[model samples]
Target chain A: MSMLKITDLNVYYGSIHAVKGVSFEVEEGEIVTLIGANGAGKSTTLNTVAGLLRPRSGSIEFEGKSLVGVPAHKMVSRGIALCPEGRRIFQDMTVRENLEMGAFTRTEEESLEMRKRVYESFPRLKERRTQAGGTLSGGEQQMLAMGRALMSKPKLMMLDEPSMGLAPILVQEIFDIIKELNAQGTTILLVEQNASMALSIANRAYVLETGRVSMSGDANELLHDERVRKAYLGG
Target chain B: MGFLTNLINGVSLGSVYAIIALGYTMVYGIAKMLNFAHGDVIMVGGYICFVCMNNLGLPVAVAILLSIVGCTCLGMVVERAAYKPLREAPSLAVLITAIGVSYFLQNSALLIWGADPKVFKSVVDLPSLKFFEGQLVVGPINIVTALTCVLIMVSLTLFTSRTKMGKAMRACSEDKGAAQLMGINVNTTISMVFAIGSGLAAIAGVLLCSTYPTLMPTTGSLPGIKAFTAAVIGGIGSIPGAALGGVLLGIIEIFAKAYIGTQLADAIVFGVLIVMLLIRPAGLLGKEIHEKV
Candidate 1:
């Protein structure tokens, strides 16, 4: 069964249609990525799924339950978490506090267990646990953002542009962590502009252009596609 | 002796300002709007306590609790009815709405309680404490006020830094969208902020009236403005900043009134604000926010 299925979704920002009739599904334990350039509505689709953006017309379902009008804050309890674009970590809070906030909807015991797992996954977070989030380096912030999202222990984790700004090595490290998280039983929905790295790690890929999906295929096939190479892979 | 007395008076008054300033800072931090109705809520709290004590003949403890609860509900109602709808509205628009709410509260109080100042019976009837061989005089009300303010500030600090709900409040203040994504009910957190802030204002109101022994429709106005100034002086979004700013402003105002001209006290307070802004725009204990591109 599909973990998340967004069908015929249309989202707008003040009458400017941002995501038009976009539809996709993420099966259980799969890493599905949506890759596109800026203005391609990749973030919009993820945000809509996370209940942050209202879709003008369409349906979002998680585990076959309609998520059309469910509020954003309630999405986590339903087992879906979105690590938003720009790595919007709470700048004033300490790193540990940010992690704690990720488990905002969980019981004390569950949250504590999740915190330990997150610390084990990202040991650097434990080292700088008391440091303010704003003080962290870009790579550290990205790690914290992912770690924070993981604190919720969601069955489906949606990350938006986790590698938007980072060194090449850091980007590789982040992708590696993403792969590891996926291997540990959390299905992933990734939105990224880094088509090369995203396509490499994703099980399936969708190419969005101008608010619509232009292509969908197995990630390996799209990685070698001629048109994809010309537009996104620097052929 | 005069200096010592003035210092005590400053601390007492500053403590009151600190309590009210906490309301301003917390609401502003979480909601990003200056809740101008905050002062009127204080007035309402004062009136609630007055009615409970004088009209209904309740004990002081119950009266205080009822007033706090009343103000908490008022804050939540104001947020739900007025500010929540305007959450996405322009800051200026929300600000204007707050001003409108403030007027609504004041006018309603005026209509109900009359324009005449009502004498507030002394809630704290403890005897005065003498210091410096009885040269300096201090009332028990002053001591209680200072102690209460300190206790509240410390507890609030712990609350925001330690509790789960408090952590969510900080997150919401930082980035509302991100906080919501974390499955935090942003609306509930904001309402909690209003509840806590208004509850503090209620206590401040009771202490304020007890100190001055007068309750009027506009009783909360001057102190409210002063507390706002204190919030700005300490850094509007920083909790510790509010407390420090309140105490400093109180001391400065008191000293100015003692040595400087009485009319110049307000000017002095504002002048200090200007100086603080010019020297350190972030205020004491306030973090400098650099907008991310």
Candidate 2:
């Protein structure tokens, strides 16, 4: 049932070992969240799986196929998409153009269809379809990023810090959207610093600390765990 | 020649500059590197066209097509060999390599074609136009160059703004990582840009030599610099900007020569550029980098 799997992922930036022996899995139709503090390997692990970062030593498998050494651009065509840490939308490009770019590997007809579907899910993006990406508000930018990722029609979508800078209201809106997406049969791998919100929506959770998996369990069970409550949920 | 005649000549010259500037602007916008060697590609194109038409006895249209194809390949090879390995290296390194490539192209031409100048045959086989008791004249090359520039500009704008590949190119220019996330191959897009730019260089070369009627190892250097200046004037990364800059620069150079001392014309042209930049640092159509805080 595992749609995505990673084992012993080790990533380094020059001499700094960022992600060391970080392993995890995302089963089909499940919301798997990785929760951790600053400098934790959460983003690093997500990027490694997304094929953006070269692992020092590890293996990444998607639907039973090896994903290691695959370039980031090739990952989307393989049914894996990463909505990166920042809402790194092409600022000068129109919303429609940004979405079109998301489906780069798809045929013209398929991309147009995907664009219509994305617009339906994010009506606000459709409203500003011709507007430049940089002009959108933070919440709208987040929606555009998520919608842009969906344009690829990936089997598993990985999000890194999607709620990082959003207001509480916008954070709630984004989480709702994520849940809505998962409910529609899309598998989600979410890496978040906001432990409580991520745990609430996630089916399962993994806790990373200083480049390793410190703890992990059923999302609800970890939510009640005393140590997790003390460290992440603010006691 | 009347004022109308002078204006047409300026516009014709500017058309060639605009075409060359498009190559500079497109590559700079997407790859974020000033392809200094882009100008030398023009010289290479000119030589290729000359060989095909003169030695092989090919027709004008076929010679130009062959030249474009050859330049496109050269651009890709240059990018792969010189620029690709240094993609992650500093911009300065890439720029130095481009200068090296420029010199290499120049020397290669000198060695192959010899340093002796070749009298370039005008590609414009059409008739020239005359008006107002034959006081004002428009050379066939002028009409051809202007139309070609306009056509190229319109198509390039449409291609970038409307097509999927064009959108991918814009995305890569903005953010390579995000573009990659969207399944766009950044390397391939960069290669495509070089291809387009160099192909344009070929057309510009033929048009340039046709108007000037002289071909040498350094035929493309002055015009290349002027086109680069044109690209800067219109805003380095903007497509329309390059066209505007090229035409404006061409007019200024022509007017300066006619009205001012012929010796001071180049100075006046450069002086206008200085004054223009001081007035609008981002160039005529360039967006100021002042991000909204």
What stretches of model 2 exceed 4 Å from their correct place? B291-293
For A121-202, candidate 1 gives per-residue lDDT tens digits of 9999999999999899999999999999999999999999999889999999999999999999999999999999999999
| lDDT measured at residue A103 in model 1 versus the true structure, 0 to 100 | 94
The DockQ figures for the candidates are 0.92, 0.90
The collision pairs in model 1 are none
User: Residues B1-293, candidate 1, lDDT per residue (tens digit)?
Assistant: 99988888899999999999999999999988999889888899999999999999999999999999999999999999999998889999999999999999999999999999999986897789887789988998889989998998899889899999888888999899999988889999999999999999999999999988889999998899889999999899888888889988999999999999799999999998889899989888887878867
Residue-wise C-alpha lDDT for candidate 2, range B257-276, written one tens digit per residue = 88887899888777877888
- Candidate 1 matches the true fold with a TM-score of 0.98
lDDT of 2 by residue, A206-227 (tens): 9999999999989999999999
- Model 1 bad stretches (over 4 Å): none
Candidate 1's displacement at residue B253, Å, is 1.7
Give the fraction of true interface contacts kept by model 1: 0.94
- lDDT, each prediction: 0.93, 0.92
